[model samples]
Target: MKIIEKMNIEKLNVIYQIFNEKDLLRKLSHQGIIKLHNFFQDENYVYLVTELANRGDLGFLIKNVSPLAINKSMIQFIIAELLMPLEYLHSIGVSHRDLKPENVFVTEEGHLKL
Candidate 1:
């Protein structure tokens, strides 16, 4: 769940960005992308309910795992998984501006989610 405080949104002047993100998430329907289940705004905050990536994110996995354990094939697989969604998004005329390890989540079955 993402809780965006109304005050912070106003302070940061990111109301448009937030709305853009919400729209993008709503339009996206790929296995590698995070699923937005619901969205609502109250008096104090905006709530975004999304799918859970129980295995956490790519950054967490990279930091916790040994470098030697990450083989070339594993790297390729991760990259391929990441690229699939990018390709899909591109085909649909969308570009993800923020692409990073922290933004890539790992699913319980060891699949990657953008």
Candidate 2:
């Protein structure tokens, strides 16, 4: 069984927590770039959870557009659009030390901002 809890401790971070059973599962779930759900055990395993993106990441989107010979303006727009999320993540005190296309998440809604 898992418990869903909101851990908003400043020390942990803007969004930080110590997950238990359910909490650990949630951390393991695939969520936003910084949004992670995790679990762990001393003699066993450590569960790192997050919100999984069924739609996948921006890198995949760019790859799919590769063969299309996309336009400069369009590419610029996409770049700008993609950067929006990055800006938010940074503003929120999160840094993407390792940023890749697969690291990004596309939600069900058309909106794209972490």
Question: What's the lDDT for residue 28 in model 2?
Answer: 30
* Full-model lDDT, candidate 2: 0.49
Q: Candidate 2 residues 34-89, lDDT tens each?
A: 35445443433334454555565667666776665678876686567667656765
Q: Residue 4, candidate 2: how far off, in angstroms? A: 22
Best by TM-score: 1
Residue 35's lDDT within candidate 2 is 54
* TM-scores, all models, native as reference: 0.89, 0.45
Q: Which stretches in model 1 have alpha-carbon errors above 4 Å?
A: none
Report the C-alpha lDDT of model 1 over 1-114, residue by residue, as the tens digit: 789999999999999999999989998999988999999999999998889989989999999999998999989999999999999999999888989898898989999988
RMSD of 1: 1.5
Give Cα distance to truth, residue 99, candidate 1, Å. Answer: 0.5
lDDT of each: 0.92, 0.49
Q: Which ten residues in a row have the lowest lDDT in candidate 1?
A: 94-103
